[model samples]
Structure formats: structure tokens, C-alpha cells
Target chain A: MKKLLVLSAFAAMLASGTALADTSGKKIAFSNNYAGNSWRQAMLDSYGIVTKKAVEDKIVAAADVFTTADKEVPTQAAQVQNLILQGYDAIVINAASPDALNGAIKQACDAGIVVVSFDGIVTEPCAYRVVVDFKDMGKQEVEQMAKFQPKGGNLLEIRGLAGTSIDDAIHAGILEGVAAHPEFKIVGSVTGDWDQTTAQKAVATILPSLPDVVGIVDQGGDGYGAAQAFAAANKPRPTIIMGNRQDELKWWKEQKEKDGYKTWSASIAPGVSTLAFWVAQQVLDGRKDIPHDLLVPYLAFTQDDFEAALPKIKEGGVATHEYTQEEAIAAIKANIK
Target chain B: MTAIAPGTLPKSSPRGNAARARLLRGLLPALSLALVLIAIAWLNPRAISYFGFNLMLNLAIPIALATIAQMFVIAGNELDLSIGTFVGFVGCVTATWLRDAPLLGIAVLLGSIGAYALLGALIHLRNLPSIVVTLGMSFVWQGLAILILPKPGGKAPDWLLAIMSFKPPYVPFPIMAALIIAAVVHFGLMRTSYGVILRGSGGNAAALRRAGWSLLKTKIVLFALTGLFGVLSGMALIGITTSADANIGNGYTLLSIAGVILGGGEFVGGRVSPIGAVIGALTLALAASPLLTFMHIPPDWQVAANGAILIIVLAARVLISRRER
Candidate 1:
């Protein structure tokens, strides 16, 4: 019995000696709800790039990704259950709904699997959330607009998907920003659903009735569409806030070159999926100090630097940064307090 | 117009051939479901167990309910495009009003069913296209859903959550629920006499009218049943998800229609099977994601693969049905 105790003590000492927890044998699964957009496509790509390296280096055993074909809550809930059944050590998810998948997520947590959610993060208390401060992003949109448009005239608001938590957060932030800066009056608002075509169509439909608009504050992915709507209507272009998409940056650059048009671009990097993966890996490694909710900074670009970053973005993809394990650890440390 | 009653066999075909065709038609949906189940079991043997079924079929109850709702509309020779949005509206109510103010929620739901009856009456009295009317009503339901639950955060009632999570001994809740849904809807729409009249309205409205039956009443009854099932579907979905989103059931429009079609229902004719529809919903809910995941198909191809699976199963159904013709 003493010999067995000594052996166990030695094993414990060996584990502490390594500094980093041994997750080399652990298997991770990524359950992504939707991949229909460029942003989601880039997220998957970033995840694939990072996890493939992690696997080859033996940082983890297997990292498989499962994406639902449709954006249904039940579909994603079912997918999460399947991942639990698959015996994955950890699951990283981009949830379909904030509250809908709690039932499945609770079951996964009960089974002792580490679940990390990002972007469309879950509201389940057991799951770890890696989310961008979308509300802050919305406030910053107006703050940045104040820089370019000193005489804030009538502003139009283009919103994201109506029922999403992110949309509500951003919309609330924008309202707060507008309240702080009384110079800007939101004369018109329309739901863009965060798609360029949908935003363009929505804006075109509502622009005819509105008076002169000097600025447009929007959640990301709809800025370029707003610009196109103004152009198509032959109305004077407004200082539109851009989401960090290649086309939005390119359009901003063209407008800059033509007439010194300046606007701010910001979005949650699609590569946050990689950060989510690393968070799951860290939790599976038995890190105790990590918080359930981790707030990560959003990626933003100003007029001076957006042109330089424009070439780095793929033709139809959003600007994203893939995080390494070290960076993910640092982020976790930053969020600890 | 020559009207062929639902129960009495047509004079055109022999009794044996008709029986064979009827049997084949009845068996086609089950065949499709079995094929999917077998494929799933083959791909991942672990997915066949009780836990596997519990997890896999978790969403099938709501889908089966939604498919039954669509079936009700189709039984009246009318299409309901608004059912998906109506479900979303009902989900919002379930998550909010039903959880908070139970009586008000029940009243609202019953009133919504009355609204559906009114829509049916309007369509009948005005001789309007069901397609156009329901399509327009889809927007109305969506708007109402958004107004009720502007954001996707709501708590499911504890009782509902408990009922949904109930685990029966030796059988998963979802499978048990699917069986109950199938048996109940089949008995209501297939075995009963009034149900035959409802099916006949779709087969030959003119004949039913000539026979002294009120076509308006049948249409209203069918639509009201659609509303009832849609509410059940919405509540079931919320009971599973534990919350509500305004766009939650938006995909059900196509899914429910596909479920009915896959279950051997025709667009123009009053041909529908409640048991077959529940099976078809199960097949679709399985084929929609689980089969693709088990196959290890990459994310890029999963969407296309999903469409391909639908095509293959539906094509098989079509070929079998053609033999019946």
C-alpha cells in the first residue's frame, strides 16, 4: 500500500512538473450550427487550420468539426446530443440560439464533457462562452462616426437578424450611443439580417421616404450593402460603419480614393472559433481558474490601416485572426479577474 | 365531376391490384424511414442504442407535430405557408405568456386558431387562393412573433421542461412521443368518419357540397386543426429547446411540406397518411443532420449531401408510387 501511494505521489509530481496539463490524449469535437455565410465559412477554415496543427503536434488526439446544414435550434440541439454520445472529451460550439440548446448543453455538462461556445454563444451556465462585446462594438460605431461626421445629421440604422441576442445587444448599444450623442437622430431603421443583399434590398425599400441622411450606423456585414443602396438610389453617400469584410474594406478604400470618404470597420473575428477550440482544450486539460464567460476584444480597423489589411482578406471572406494556444491562454488569463 | 369516395375502391383497377398499390403506398414511408435508420446504424453502430435514439430523435416530436399540422391543411386541398411562422409565434407565446400568464396564453392560442378559421372562411367566401393568403399570413405571424419576443431569450415553464425531459423506462421520450403523435393523429384523421369528410373535401369539394355538406365548415375545421397542431408543435419545440426565437420554426414550412410529400401525400389530391407523415418526419429529422455527421462529410459538402439524401429517398418514393399508378 505504501508503494502504491508513493507511485501515485510520483505521478502527481510528474503532472505538476510538466506545467501544462496533459491533453494529448483527449479528443475534441466542434459542433457548429450554421456555415451558410462567408463569416462562418472563414470560422470553419480557421478552426481547421489551428486544430490540424494541434493534432499533428499531439497537443490533442482528435479534433472533429460537425456543422448543421440548417439554422434550426432543434437541429443544433440534436447535434450537441450526438457529440455527447460520440464521447468527445470536449465540444466547441457556435450555437443556433442562446437559450434553446440549454437542455442538450446541460446533459453534456452532466456527462463531464467540456463545452466551449463562441460567436453565437449559448446561455447555458455550464458552458464556457467566448464572446465579443457586441454592445461595445455598437457604441464604438457611433463614437467612430462622431470622428468623421462632426455635424451628425440624420442617421439611418441597419440591424442584424432580429431575434438574435447579438442584434439586441448591438441595437441597445447603438441606442445608448445615440442617447449620449443627441446630435444624431435615427430617422429610419430596418433589419438587414446581416447579409449584404438583404441589407441592400431593405435599405432600398426604406430610403425613398427618408430625408437627407448623413451617417448610417449598422452592425457589421451590412455597411457595404447600405453603401450600395445609397449609390443605386443616386443619393449622397453617408459615412457608413463597416464590418471587417473584404468587400466593405475595398468599398471604403475606393470611396476614399475617389473623394476622401472615411469610415470605421469592426467585427468579431471569424477566427474566434480557434480561440474557442483552445478554450475547450484548456478546460479539458483541467484548468480550474478559467471563468465561464470570457470576453474577447473585437477586431477593428480605421481608415488609415484598413487599406493595408484589405489585401490580407480573401475575396468574399471577413477579416479574421487565428489564435495560437499561447494567445488563448493569455486571453483566459486576462478574463480571470 | 366524378367523385371517387375515399374508402370505396375505384372501378378502374382490380381489387388485388388496388390492394397491392394501397399496401405499397402505405409501406413506402416506413421503408424510407427504415432505410435511414439502417444507414445510420451501419455508419455508427453506437447510434442505435436507447441513449442513441434518445439523443438522435430528440427533435422528432416537434417535427412530427409540425408535419401533422401541414397534413391538416393539405387534407383540405389547401396549402399553409404560414404554419412555420405560426409555430414561431406560438413558441414565443409559450416561452413568454404561457410561462408567465397561463390563462392568457391559452386564450391567445385558441384565439389564433379562431383566426385561422377566419382565414379559411375568408378564402372560401372570397374564392381566394390558399397559397397567396397563407403566404401573406406568414409575414403577419413572423411580425407578431418578433413583436412578442424581440430577442431570443425566454424560459420554458418548469412543467413543460419536465414533461419534455421525461424518460420512460425501456424507451426514449422522443420515440414514445412520436408513437403517441402518430397513433393519435392517425385515429383522428384516418379512422374517424368526420376525418373522411375532411379528406373528401380535398378529393372533390364540389361533390361534398352537392352532398349537402358545408364546404366552408370543412375548410374552417381543417385550418383550425392546422392551427391546433401548429400550437402543439411550437410548444413541443420550446419544451425541448427551453426558449423561443422569432425565426425558430422558419424552416418548418419546407420541412413539414417535405415530410408530407415524403410520407406519400400528393399536392392536388387528398392523399395523406398520418402514420406515414410521422415516419417521414422521423426520416427527415434523421437525414437532415445525423446521417451526414456519421458519414464524416465535411462542412462544405454537408449541405449538398443533405440535399442529395433528400433526393435519393424522395426519388425512391416517386419510383414506387409510379408503379402504383
Candidate 2:
């Protein structure tokens, strides 16, 4: 029975391989807004690796990436228009503004182009969104902290970039978590802008005024900085939530070996750009049943599994998972219901 | 946009040399514009079409407006470091108040312009550096913008949306808007008598004072004009983007300065050309990112390439003006 099931799975794989051939002559473009940080760099790297193989395998004719020099909404909007004019079959975007790019995105939809946005997803109804449950991840951070600290006290919240949807969602989730677990009290909050340096500076500034006794909750790209701030201040260390960055994980490993420090880490994988790329390809391949919004799980690590994943992540890069076409289809299937 | 002698061209000087210098100065801006246009067309012939321009230059309208705003300050031999944030503040207002409450929005916008006039009066009376005053105002405007809209979501007014997306038959909206802006500003600040007074204040304030022109009024008017155009720029930006972010217009500060310089406007002496400034704004709008896109430059090098393009064009302008000297 096992042999028969394996033979049938092989046949199903063969069938999907033939189905992928329909998009062999089409081209897709990735329109990225910014690449100033490690997360975005890893995103582009994963996209390059995945799309290079896709092109080599003739899954698509070409997959090119275009990143705007400035992190301005209008610049990225103009880029989408250019991609439309260039006649790409589809465009995958990590947008600058969720709604500011809607004009350009609507123009793309009017021109009959498929647009799939991830990470910094757009609100345009015509576009496909591949989102990770950031709120859940935020809630999970506190839950994990509960497991380690057992007795929660004051918490320092390091927020992401100001005026971003992801930042708001994660903040809301953390607030909800604290409400449910009344022991965790958020004493102070600082805007980190999702950068290590910025987070360090912000935490350093607020540390002098706050009573942070137990743990630190933060949006990704900021954990290491908070730890650094705590170290520089010569304060007792807290159970800080990590953001799946290599440096954060590396620091966690060091602390774990020294004193058995426990924590949790989670972030939307940067390689989600590749998943967005695959979604665009699927849409271009005449898949009408795909939902407009596909929610995938965030990349996360705990004390037991984080060390194993740390070495695989590039130096100064975030932990990431490049999505294959099968995994993308599975994600789509899961979202369908 | 024709080459017009900017201001009192030294009536007693070597007349031929003065005329030649003025002509070269006027032509330098157009030359830079033409070089960028030709480079774009050469890189990708497809970008020369009407649709191509509409898409490529979609954001140029606001940029040109912002440049014109900067030109007014430069014309008075002063600078506005706050215009960018001011525009962002205006954009936040347009996206929220302008859409929800029209009368309040209009009042607030006009009030802000009045505030600018007041700033001008204060700067003139106190003998404060325009640079320092405007620099401080930049933070004030940014804070106000964030207060109005903490997040990056607001709808552009329907009328604004309709006006911005309007497609004229032969010419693109951005091009049409640029021409109108250039023509109207050129007439107002170049041919009119009061415009001469304004420029004269920058050229020779003592002579203007002796001539019985109120330098205070000119400064106020210049600043109010900057406020007016900045509001328009912010509104146009939101109309195009269909939403607002508090940081949306932050880039305009440097870009506006660059546009004014690229358009052959001088830092002091009221040596500014409205038509040339408009052309310069267009040149920058095109060169900022479109040229790099057409050139297929790598993303990693695009910012550096943008700087190189700016340097090359400005260098050519300097070289041309030098030849006339």
C-alpha cells in the first residue's frame, strides 16, 4: 500500500510539472521599494536564487527585480507603471505604502497584469496578498515569555517603523497578549523603526526612564539592539523576544550557553518575496481558483530549535525560507477554504 | 520657454558680453534638459511615446510645483528648508480634512499660507537667517503632519482624483501642467513690474529701498507664494498617490533645491528664470529615476548613478556658462 501511494505521488508531481510548462514563455517582474537593510537584502537574495532556478528550468521566460533607490511611495508607484509599460505578464511587489501605490496598482490591473504583494502588502482588491499572521506571532512572543519567566513584570516594547500596518498589527497583538496575561505590564514603549542601530538608540534613550524587570517584546530587527542597550546600561538581562535575525540568534546562542537564557523569535520570512513571485506565476498560468489573500505562517525559532537554524542563516541576515512552487500551491490551497 | 534676460543686465557694461552671458545662462538649463531627454530616448526608444511619458513622468507634476516654490525663495535670495515638510503637512491635511470637511480644509491651507507670510515678516524684522528659520520650521511641519495622520492611509478628494488623472488628448497631463506652470510663473515674476521689485530686492536691496519699494512686503509675498505652491505640490502628490503618509514629501526638500539649481537659478542676486527653472524641474524629474530605469542600471548602483547624472548635467551647464565668460 505504501509503494502504491508513493507511485501515485510521483504521478501527481509529474502532472504538475507539465502544468507548469504553460507559463514557460511568460515574464514576471519584482518591484521592490527599498533594500537598505538586511531583511530586504535577504529578500532580494532569495528572490534571485528562486527566480534564477525558475528561469533556468524554463518555468518562466524571465524574472527580473527592480528596486527603487528611495523609499518613496511615488517612486515605487512610478516603477509599477514602468513595469506595466514594459509589458511584463505579472509584477510582484513589496510596496512602499499599502494604499499610496493603489493608483499605480489599479493601473496595472486595468492593463491586465497580475500583481502579487507580500511583506508590505497592498490593499488593492485586484492584487493578491501573501500575508503572515504577524499578530499571532506577537501574541506567541508573550506566550513563549510566559514559559520562561513564569512571573512576568514590566515589559519594554520596541515598535517597528512608525505608520506601517505591520507595526500596528504587531503592537495590537502585544497589547492583546498583555491584557490576557495580566502579569505582563508594558512600562515603556519606543519606536525602533525596525533597524538594529535605531532600536539600540531608542532603547538606550528610554532605558534611563523605565522600570523593565522581566522581558522585552519587540518587532523584528531590534532584539539584538535591545540586548546591547541593556548590556551597556549594566542592567540585569531580561527575556527579550528575538526577530529571527542572525545577530539576534547569535547573541541568544551566546547567552544561552553562558546562563541558559530562554527566549522566542519570530518574523515574516524575507523569502516570502519568492512566494509572492510564485503566486504571480500561478495566476499567470491561468489559475482562477486562487484566493486574493493567502496567509502563511511566520518563520519562528525557540530555544530548542533556534541554534540549529542559526548557522544556516547568512551572516548579518535574517532567518528565511525560500518557498517552492509546491509549497506555494499548498499555501494557496490552505487559504482557499 | 524662451531665453529672456533675467534682470537689470548691467546697462553700462560691455553690452555684448552681458547679453552673451545672459543668453548662455538661459540656454544652459534647456541644454541640460535636452541632454537628459536625448539620453532617455537613446536608452529606450519606447519611452519617447505619449503613453510612455504619462507613465514615466507621472510624479513630475508635484516635483515641478515644488521646484517653483523653491524658486520663489531663491528669487528673494533666501532659502526654504521647510518646504518639503510643509508639503507633507499640507498633504496630510488634503488627504484627511480636505476630503472630509472642505471648508475647514480650505481654511487651514489658507491659514498655513498666512503663517508663512508671518514667518517672512518675522525673518525680515528680526534679521534672522532664512536658512535657520526655515530649518526649524521643517520640524514643526513634520510634527503637525504626523499629528494629523499618524498612519499612511487617507483618501484623496474625488475632485482632486479626477483632476489629477485627467488625460488631455495630445499632451500628457504632467507636460501640460509643467508648461502652464512655467508660462504663468514666468509672466508673473519676469514681466510684471512688482516682479521686478521682488527681483530687485534680491539684486540690490539698498537700491530697492531707495526706490521706495517695501523689501518687507516683497519678502512676505515671496514666502506666501512659496506656501501657496507648496500646498499645491502636496495636494497634487496626494491626488496622484490617492493616499497620504506623513513622510511622503520628505524627499522634496533636497529635490526642490536641486531642481532650482539645475534650472539655472542662482543662490543669491535674484538671478532666477521661471521657464528655465521649470525645464530644470522636468530635467530632474526625468533624470531622478526614469533614466536609470531605461539604462537598465542595477539597483545597487542606481542611487550613485543618479548622483553622477546630476553632476554631469550641472558640470555641462557650468562649462557652457564658463565659455561665455
Candidate 3:
């Protein structure tokens, strides 16, 4: 027993020595919810480049990445567990669901692994919530539409996964925007799971019923599908459709060549994977001063803005680390509430 | 159960053999869809408009196709869990690689179908139970889909998009194609020698082996047809969605099985119809529309309702079959 205790004591001492390694060099692991979509894939690719560049330039000592292409909660949670087991000082997460991921976040925080959530917000204090100002996002879409429809008109709000924080936040934002415009009558709303098919079909079905409906406040991917639905019906398209998907901007431009591209505009978006990285950095460096929440910058886009952003985004990749650690911290502090 | 050649029951008696086929062919499917529709109407009739009707039919296409694909394999006494992931993978790849080139888009689809068919056949030839292989293959296909697209964004042309959102006055193109496939598959299974041999193989593989026919060959053909349906469905959805997303075919896995049984087909094997699958698929779509309209039900509840409907329909079919026995 004494021999075993001595062995265990030696192991603990070694672990302590490694943890306090003076290089201020610690491994930061970026865990994701699958790089399955073009936007997600692009985001991950950008994360790779930015994390690598930052590490190479001595911004951080070492970096690691883990992904769950299945995008399931358990798989992503396992990735976090594995990162924790590997003794990463801090972990960044693009949680599939805030509630479902709470246990993992708690485990990491309890174990002294700082947890920062981006894109998807976890309600618990353990998370430093970094998200887009989705309410502003919703209000922006309406305001953009207000430019076209000076008189409030009938609207359809195509939503994402129901009951999810991301969808709810965005939906709440859209409603707040709608509150300002009493003239805008909400014709109908449906959950597309943020899928293109459901969005397209929902809009198409609703279109024949509501011919007077002038616009739709879409949740990202659904915007493109809604646009197609409008085109299919051979009706004069809506004056305003808000698309928050950046990767799709390129496709919108290509489509605009034949059809007038002015049919839709994007509010703003935070890169999920990029947010995960920044959150990891923040947690690892022990900057608890950051407020409970932060908003990733958003860029509302027009056809011309898409034309400009497409090359920069596609070439540089989404989440291309425009802000350095100091700049990112400042930005977070500036927006934190 | 019907594998025996009865003394008085006669060989391949339509009552003993064709009864299951007939139920799935016309009667059971039509009844289930009608009952579900009636229930939905009672729950909420406002969702029964022409637009809602179109939405239901459109929603059913992909699920129906996957169900029919599953039916082909299950009917042959095998299983293919990979078909869902296959559709997702092929759908994304076809949409991504040939988003602009319509001809190549179609060609890529055909090639994927061909590849899956060949792969299925190879798996069967290696003496592997398809369920195990297909389970692993589903993961592989899903992973590939992610690797290929990573994010759910891409541009499929507007012309293709038009077909999905616009259903004609006389007949919807999707429904028409579905009808044609149904008729072709139905007649091919009932009238052709190929059909008899394949159905017979499912009933008594050892007996068919004694008769000097290759069950392997027939099963391979079934796999091929299943792959073909997935390809067609993927292409159709590409038009509807106008963008290829990696998770486009999610929930299609279990939903396909639910559709098959609700369409009055059995899990054991033998007898499935493309028409029955369409009815089955549409039944599922309409099942939830009313809840969306009036019941203020969530999709999770609707999914539960679908499962319940499927169970009741399948149980009733089993009872009727037993009573006939």
C-alpha cells in the first residue's frame, strides 16, 4: 500500500508539473458539431488556418481539434470528454444543443477547464455566451423590408429547429422587429428545421393561400428555399427576404445573374467554429472579466455586398480570425452584457 | 409461413400467397391513407386546402422513395439500413458536383445508383447479412456526405427548382413519375418470370436453390431497384430544395420503415409496391398537417402519432391475415 501510494503521489506530481509548464504553452482543443455542411465545413477549415497561424506566431502554444460529423449530442459530448481527458486547459464548443451539452460544460468547468460557448448559448453560468444579437438580426430584417414596404405588409416567418435556443432567440428577435411594425401582419409561421426543403415547401403552400403576403423573415438556409418557392409559383417575389447564411451568398449571386438578385438580403452571422475557438482562448487565459454574453459581429449584405464578401469569405474562409486575441477580447468586452 | 405447398391449398394459391401481395398492392394502403386522412380532417380541416395537399404529397416523395427502397430489400428477406445515408450522400454529391450541369447531374445520380447496386450485390455475394453491412455502410455514407459538403449550402439551378415548387394542374410530375414507377414495379413483380423467381426465392431459398435458380442473382436485382428509387428521389429533392445540404435525408432512416409497414407490407419479406409506398408516405405527411393547423401540436408529437398509426395499421393487417388463415 505504501509503495502504491508513493507511485500515485509521483504521478500526481508529474501531472502538476505538466499543468504548470512555464511556456504558458497549453493545448487548446476546438470541438465541433460536424463539418458536414458547406458553411460548417468552411468554418472548420477557417478554424484550422486561423488557429494554426495564431499558434505558429506564438499567440498560443499548441492547438488541437475534434469533430463530430454526426452532429449528435452524445458524440459531441464524447469529444469534449476526450479533450478533457487529454488534459486540455480550456475547451471551445459549438454545442449541438445548449441544454443537452450542459453536463459536459459542467464537467469541464468543474475540472478547471474553462467553457466558452459560441453560436449556441448555454443558459448556465459556466458558459461565456457568445452569440449574434439575433433580436437585432430579426429587427434588421424587418427594417430592411421596411425600406421596400414603407407600408407594413403581410409576412411569413420561416423558423429553424423549434425549441432550440438558436431558433428561439432568432424567432424572438424577428417578433420584436415585427412589434415595431404593426402594419406587418404575420400570415403564418412554420418550423423548417432550418432545412431548405421544408422552407421551400412551407412557403410554396402558404403562397397560394396568401397571395398578398409581401415578404418572409427566414431563418438562414430557409431563405434560399423560400426564394425558389416564390420563383416556382411564378409570382412577383417578396420585396424582402432575410438570409443569414454567408456560404449561400455565393450561390445567390450566381442565381441573381439570370434572376434579379435583389430578392433577398442577409442580416449578420457569427461563425460557429470561430466563436468556439475564441471562447476556448478566453477560458484558457482566465479572463473571467468578460460579461455573461458576447455578440459575434454581423454584416447585413446586399447583392453588391455579397459580390464583395464572397471572394473574401470563400478565399479567406468563414471565421478567418479578423480579430487578434486583444482585439477579440476588446470586442467581447464592448458587446458583453 | 406460406412456404409450404399444401395438398388442398394448392401450389402458390392466391389466397395463401397473393393475399399479402394484394393487401400491400391496393387494399391495406388505400385504407390506411384514407383513415389517416379522415382522422386529420376531423382534427383540423383547415389544413386540407389544395396548398396543404401539395405540401403533403411533396413531403412524402423522399420518404416514400426510401421506404420503397427498403421494401425491395426487406421483401427479399434482407435489410439495408444504408439506404438513408446513401440517399443523403448521393444527394449532396450529385447536387454539389453537378449543380450547374443538368445532364451531368442526372448522370452522376445514375452512377451513384449503379455503384450502390453493385456494392449491395458484392456485399450479398460475400455471404454477409445485409443488416450488419448496411448499418456500417450508413455511417460510411453519412461520413462521406459530411466530408463532401461539410456545410449545408450549394446552388442548384432555378429551372430544376421550378419543378419542385410548381405542380401542374392536370397531374403533378412527381406523382406521375411515382405512378409510372408503381405500375411498372407492380406488373414486373406479378407478371414477369423474374418476379415469380424472386418472390419464390424469398419464400423458400433452399427450395429455389434445388430448382437451380440463383437467389443471389435475384436479390442483387432487388438491391439494384432499391438503389434506383433512392437516386430518383434524391434528384427530385435537389430540384425542390435548390440546395444540397448534408443532412437533407435525416430522419429518413426509421421513417422509411414506418412507411413500409403502414403501407401494409410486412417486415418478414415478400410483396411490396411503389404505389402502396406513395400512399404510405403521403399518409404520414397529412397525419401531421392538421396538428400544425389546429391542434397546436409539436413535430415530436406528430412523429409519435405517425408511429402509432403505423403500429395500428400493421396490427390490423396482421389480424386480417390471420383471420384469413
- What residue runs in model 1 are displaced by over 4 Å at the alpha carbon? A1-21, A145-157, A175-193, A196-216, A226-240, A254-263, B1-19
DockQ for every model, please: 0.61, 0.54, 0.02
Worst 10 residues of 3 chain B by lDDT: B291-300
What is the per-residue lDDT of model 1 for residues B194-305, given as tens digits with 9 covering 90 to 100? 9999999999888889999999999999999999999999999999888888888998998999999899898776889898899999999999877878888877887788
How does candidate 3 fare on TM-score? Answer: 0.49
Model 3, B195-295: lDDT tens per residue?
Answer: 87877766677888998998778877888888887776666655544456566675567767767766766666575555677677666554533322233
Instruction: Give model 1's TM-score versus the native structure.
Output: 0.89
Question: All models: lDDT?
Answer: 0.90, 0.89, 0.66
Q: What's the distance in Å from true for residue A187, model 3?
A: 51
Q: Isolated chain A: TM-score per model?
A: 0.94, 0.94, 0.82
Backbone clash pairs for candidate 3 read: A35-B150, A36-B150, A36-B151, A37-B150, A37-B151, A37-B152, A38-B151, A38-B152, A39-B151, B75-B270
Candidate 3 is graded, for docking, as: incorrect
In candidate 1, how many Å is residue B183 off?
Answer: 2.1
Q: In what order do the candidates fall by DockQ, top score first?
A: 1, 2, 3
Please give the distance, in angstroms, between residue B225's alpha carbon in candidate 1 and its true position after superposition: 2.1
Tell me model 2's lDDT, rounded to 2 decimals.
Answer: 0.89
